[model samples]
Target: MGKATGFLEYTRINPKKRSPEERIRDWNEIRLPRDPEVVKTQGARCMNCGIPFCHSGVLLNGMASGCPLHNLIPEWNGLIYKGQWEEAYKRLTRTSPFPEFTSRVCPAPCEGACTEGHILESVTINSLEYEIIEKAFAEGWVVPRKGKATGRKIAIVGSGPAGLSAAYYLNTVGHEVTVYERSDRVGGLMMYGIPNMKLEKRIVERRFVLLKESGINFILNTEVGNDIPAQELVDQYDAVVLCAGATKARGLDVEGSQLKGVHYAVDFLGVNTKSLLDSNLQDGKFISAEGKNVIIIGGGDTGTDCVATSIRHGCKSVYQFEIMPEPPAQRIEESNPWPEWPKKLKVDYGQEEAISLSGKDPRNYLISTKKMAGNEKGEVKEVHTVEIAWVKNASGRMVPQEVPGTEKVWQADLVLLAMGFLGPEDRIADELKLDRDSRSNVKAEYEVFQTNLDKVFTAGDMRRGQSLIVWALQEGKLAAREVDKYLMGKSVIK
Candidate 1:
């Protein structure tokens, strides 16, 4: 709308990243700082469609269609094009509580649903967002907000994206908010589950400092259900919001899964990050992938993260296994049409680094792990796998059926299970006696976010199971709104 022919005039240019060889040597962010002029031109590429699907924030084919936070995409893009960066940052923060976190970690479903992507390439929405927030921070435009005291007290369990979001909004409305983190630091999974190369710890710490300046209280290294009883919090606070993530890592149930060298992906990532932060890996408390041929059992983001981390640790070789078939190189429009998340092959950072070193992608599609073989010391030594085909059963459900004569074995010094999570842990849920859904997640309806218990609520992964951080942020914001309405009988939070 700003340039009229901007969409036609400007081709999309992605942000630059450090080369694989250079980046693999250290634990630092992969993306280079964006050039302001390049970002402005990228912003001009937004057509500002009559119907901006980029911010629809809906679900199609069970995957997120657009920005889950419903970001004001067109408005900010227009602002950036006109050289009004401060205003663009203001428009961004109107809805998003943490653009810094999402700009780094989110898969950017918004771009997938962009109108421009339906024809030409999508506008560089993600890159524009990253620049706007970074500029805001550098210019000191970011500030804490706290409303007049409502005298209401609220407690949030877990200091992850969801919990932190709820705390931010609730504190902004002048409610006394206290966040309880079981870990030694804040930002839950963002603090440790995520590797440093993707999202630096300092970015999270920066936001934590702002939230503290806003007067929201933080209690670290203290778990609610363990250090103090759940009932005590229920009695102490006017309301309690459970943002405890779906942290029960799904186990790889197979022979020799108990081998000493086999470990959960979360444990591997978390321990490595903690050790890195505490002693720069000098403590020797973390698992080392050095001098090991690693096998990752799962082809998700977590698995990709493991591959990257392993490369950083100087792994000899690595391979990722996926039970599903490989996605097509391009979107199959007949099946995966526009507005739905496109199912296509993408060479992520991990695969890029692996390919740079080995001249081949590390992912193995349509492969399933049968079992793990261990050495005399009870340490995993090799992984047994088989290629499979998806076939319809009598129930009309697609299931993995073993292909004939496809068994294979590969040497593996370490095995990482990146199969995702099951649900929230039982400690807090059991103590609170909260009802659960069929999938073992806490029973809390979307938008409502209220549990069966009085004055108690749930949001994020605990309520919806394993999901994107964007969804968690939205859930937290909505849950905060519901809490505000319940407390004041009318709420100002939108």
Candidate 2:
């Protein structure tokens, strides 16, 4: 520990955010420049807990409690506090291959499981991570580190976090790696699914450039099961790793779901980002929310992103509906003890923008959408919703039961369904004849990452269902080791 009493002497602080009023008018990131001294102070707040749970990466009550990558939190915090910026960056990259992506968008479970957070606020682990990586880039510490060629070729499908991480590790181990992306650009979710305001496209592009420089080949606008035959990849490459991600969006099964203005959140966000990148959004090739009353179904990060995106689109108003009950503002001590991931209310940036613009939080909890009403032109105009109560059914399982006489209708022209993904799109799995889990995720075990078919491996959301980027990175690293072992009968990838 840099300072034994540092935690007691310092309080946690996050980076400043751009004012909602000013930030909403543009597509730039809402975060302000971070102060180095403030980041050092934040790092000093990391208590030297003998049994630090911040890196445990365990799932408590179905939620992540710490960094999934098992980051060396205390070591980096000490390094940062001692003003060893380069050393801190080195320690950070040792576990996380892409701190830039996680720092921007990952829900920091490390902070949630911080020892100091047992009583007070947690240390700003995510912000500190961002600062460390950005400094590394600025100091030119980030450079290509290619390994000697092993005369082996590996093909990776998908260019998301998992695929990228696997390529990084495998390429560093002397194998020639090639990444295939269906989209014209790299970074599947980070480039398209996420709004530009959250993770700027240039940040993703920067990594792409560095990756190419490191001798990894990226084939854009290529789909494995479509443009390129899946069997061909299996026969050509020494090993094939699938990190295509779980992108099958859960659909709204209500009436008028097929209406013109109704769209999946992923499609809406992807289109907007693509348009923004191609022509600064002047092409009008995306679904516009301008002057329309927007209704977002779901309450997770995706729905929150939709709320924020709609606000930036100059939507007349926004309303978010969540089927679950609102969580407590503070942790319930008896159930949610210290070191567990707190199941408490969190007002994310989108809700903050909604509050700033609408004078109230736009979330309506314990409400379920009943149906959508469309106008004569086949465009959605209103959403019918009903209040719900969770009650124990005959099976003793809690189920949402609609409250009678509580149905309400709200005016809406654009409806975004962000209820999360069900599983990976079945096309790739089917084309490859790969086994699937009961939940439709690609059948592969953790750590092993081997599919039923030989020479085929799977990782990331594609295997585990929808999950965090940190988990994707972890899966990729593990899968790379398995592939390496499969290729050479042994692996040196750690």
lDDT of 2 by residue, 1-494 (tens): 86888888987777899988888898998888877788888888888789888999999988889999999999999999899999999999998898999999999999889988988898888999989999999999999878888898999999999999999999988899999999999999989899998999999999999999999999999988999888899999999999999999999988999999999999999999999999988999998999999999998999999999999899999999999999999999899887788889999989999999879999999999999999999999999999999999999999999999999999999999999999998778998889998999999899999999889999999999999999999999999999999888898887
Give the winner by TM-score.
1
lDDT of 2 at 343: 85
RMSD of each: 0.7, 0.9
> Runs in model 1 with CA error above 4 Å?
none
Q: Name the lDDT of candidate 1.
A: 0.95
